[model samples]
Target: MVKSRSETRAHILETAARLLDDEGAAALTIRAVAQAAGLQAPALYRFFEDKDALLDAVAEHVFTTYVTGKAAARDGDPVADLRAGWDAHIGFGVANAALFGLLVTPGRTSPVAEAGLVVLRARVHRIAEAGRLRVPERLAAELVHAAGTGAVLTLLARRPEDRDPGLAEAMFEAVLARILTDAPTPTDTSPDLSKLTVAERALLAEWLDRD
Candidate 1:
């Protein structure tokens, strides 16, 4: 049976992604992908404008799978959700070092990278809505992205046995300390004494009584 055009395109992307994962970015040429997908190089160009476009599609396809799993893992706690996202990002980067490097390489804007940023921003927005974010949502997201990416790259640079196991968690804690409030907004009417000064406590009690 003849495959539909969309199916053919998806097959090409899948083949390319497998090749990328198995052989790294250096092996992702139009000739190589076309050969793997059982298509002529010129025929492959019908779906992708060039080799770079094909690589972008492959990256997007792989990244979508990663992000879908991360989204499914989200629970109600915004802070926990953000932490899970960080762990997911680092895990993906470490496991797919070549793909991650390709996605983050200068001068190339992969949809995969953008999708990851969107997830990060959404997670940060949740914290902002909960009043747990001390920094502006955009800035907070940027900070987290910077730190997470740096941690992943730093870890990837070292030999597996030599890499610091706690590096990612430590970097995350440092970034979290900068972005999150000391405490989330109190749901109950009672004041949190530890977070308030004696004078502030009196003011809060008076305000609570007036409510």
Candidate 2:
């Protein structure tokens, strides 16, 4: 049976992704993908405008799969959710170095990366609503995104054996400390105000001034 247009497109993307994963982006040329997919080079142009377009689609496909899996496995605690997301992001980058590099190349605005950022923003917003976020939600999200991406890139730059096992976790803790409050915002009916020290009171005043 002949494949429909959508089926053919999906097949092409899947083939290209397999080639990319197995051989790296250097081997993901239009001619190479065409040969792998058992189609004429010109036929690939029917689904993708060019090599860059095909690579973008492959990145989107792979990243969408990763994001979908994480979404399905989401935990209930917002903070824990963010931590899990961070770990998953680093793990994906480490496991798929070439694809991760393609998705996060400097100056490239990838749809896949944007989708991940959207999830991060939602998680940060939840933290803010819970009064645990120290910074503005958008700023908190950006900080986390930047730190996470940088951590992955830094680790990927080193030999696998030389990479610090604690690097990603340490970076995450540093970012978290900057963005999350030690406790929920104080309330009128809350525990004794005398429990807070002068330094703690000053920190609370500073937090209130952030708005």
Model 1, runs deviating above 4 Å: 68-71, 185-211
Kindly report the root-mean-square deviation of model 1 from the true structure over all alpha carbons: 7.1
Worst 10 residues of 2 by lDDT: 184-193
- Per-candidate TM equals 0.80, 0.80
Tens digits of lDDT, candidate 2, 81-119 = 899889989988987799998888889877777888988
lDDT of 1 by residue, 1-211 (tens): 8999999999999999889889989999999999999999998989999988888888888877876775655689999999998998898899878889998899998877887799889999999889897888889999999999899999999999999999999999999999988988666775458988899989888998994
What are the lDDT figures for the candidates, one per model?
Answer: 0.89, 0.89
Q: Candidate 2 regions off by >4 Å?
A: 68-72, 187-211
